[model samples]
Target: MDHFLTFSLLSLLLSFAAAGDFSDDQLIRQVVPEEEQSVNLLNADHHFSLFKAKFGKSYSDEKEHDYRFSVFKANLLRAKRNQLLDPSAEHGVTQFSDLTPTEFKQRYLGLKTPAFLESAQKAPILPTNNLPEDFDWRDKGAVTGVKNQGSCGSCWSFSTTGALEGAHFLATGELISLSEQQLVDCDHECDQDGVCDAGCNGGLMNTAFQYTVKAGGLQLEKDYPYTGRDGKCQFDKNKIAASVANYSVVSVDEDQIAANLVKNGPLAVGINAAWMQTYVKGVSCPYICSKNRLDHGVLLVGYGAAGYAPIRFKEKPYWIIKNSWGESWGEDGYYKICRGQTHDICGVDSMVSTVAAFQSTSE
Candidate 1:
């Protein structure tokens, strides 16, 4: 009887995968009713009591998902953290939030930012010089789609691979889109359930680079297509290619960033996009937005320093950023961060990763 029940569950899961009915987010929605309910309630509720009730239930469900994702993110973050935390480690995490956003802007944007820039300067800046040159940075292209990692919190893999795809083009002049599926399928530094957990929470680009180099490289999308979920590791020897470079970080002011763009190309920067800041629209004014906390990461590609109003945001300059979420998002796969704002809300002065050659030129 027990065996029959196990077989029945397996059959159901297989059927769902075969029919493409189960997506990561969808699976969470199905298993965790509170997520859907919270969104629904948010759209519906007006009174406090109702909101509280709905929020409580949502929180309950979110905890379960968060726990699951935490485990996955932990795996990746832990390794990267260990590397960053190691006293002997060559690289260390830099915190650049101490400088008011205005100071960062004035130094980098060559313009005075809104008063809010003062507060944003306190955010942390990691040590990384991963930004590339303007011509080198490609548009997000046709692959800006966002994928859900399912019960797994392997956002580290998605984020790492996403940046690598861009970095590969900038470095090798190869516009080939590599595979995230390869990392998901092969990386065994963590669990094998296909759900990346604490063993795989958040990862750095370095790990991905190491994996590619050691394993030879990854295949094109067509060769190792994403199943939207993890499966048995199927290594296709023919899919191998050249390896990528080991990434490094560099911190710069907003002015330095613009100067770098004029001299080099694009760069990757980390920003704090807390839960509330998830809404990307209606952010015309910096402080006006409800959420002031940051928690997300993005890449800065170019700066609009053309006319009399060379900068964006009234008194501050703006830098163009490429995001992972396909072209459907943020000013067509791009958005502008008010450089040198009062508090670095947009990460005006942050860490970026680019090729060593590009770094030498920028310096």
Candidate 2:
């Protein structure tokens, strides 16, 4: 009976190893070496101390501090598990380490998908021949500096404005920082799914674009600044800084997505952002990220290749995603997700859209 039990336990372990089960953090903790686990535990308190200092985090009282400490330790173990799953990338304590995964998702991510994506026009197929090995819109004087969306779930607004800002720059040679607050306050369009743009609650970029076209245009950031909260609409149509002529959806093809970025401007995209909580740096290409469960919206400003080149394609190239989580986050509010040989690596290439035509007013 002891032999039988031992055999069953061995089979279970092998099955878990083969399946790459991450259902429980403790299960993955077993992957760490015993000596290394001890070292990690010993250093966890030290790491948490540094994290609090670096991020300027503090608890109100002893009880809160104790609770936060326990949460931080759990995050450290989670980071270890993530590091193993994504060996090429680095994962550790972040500003969001203290928050539970559910809280983080609710506070930071705010992308609500429409039932059907048939609203936007389809972009024309641009030539992909002679595409640069590395391309960045920032160097070309298009992309604005990184901006934080605060604790608001207004990421969809940022994504929409980022694409429009790039389009405006290409048209008028002016890289103006547009207003995300405008979308958050004024526009509230709903799709067939009945999921409407509810300010800080959540929204979709395509619907925001539609609202932009209908509302005539968007105002400047200085005029309608972000307050990081939902408020009454203060859109001044007379102070329209930029207008979207039309927006279009891009093909799922990576080469075409590159073509759109190079020719049109930055592309607005949706991503899962599941592992982004603990992500600090390096290219984030996790072993198990769902491509359909996109929860956050971001702008695709550029793409580059790192390491070897002779064996190009998926092995080297990566997409540069401009996030709205402030400059203190991953790669200065930017994320590099690896390119796969086939479809996508976390819906980055799935729900892609870009500004087809636009007009911008001068300062």
- The most accurate candidate by lDDT is 2
Report per-prediction Cα RMSD to one decimal.
20.3, 5.5
lDDT of 2: 0.82
Model 1 worst lDDT window (10 residues) = 110-119
Model 2 weakest lDDT span, ten residues long: 307-316
**Which lDDT value does model 1 have at 36?**
20
Q: Tens digit of lDDT per residue, candidate 2, span 216-329?
A: 899999999999999999998888999998888998899999999999999999998987998998777665566767889999999986623221222556899999999999
Residue 48, model 1, lDDT: 29
**Residue pairs clashing, model 2:** none
Q: TM-score for every candidate vs. truth?
A: 0.47, 0.88
lDDT of 1 by residue, 114-199 (tens): 11211122223433255332332444341234443432334444545555555555554554555666766775432222222221
Error of 1 at 151 (Å): 7.8
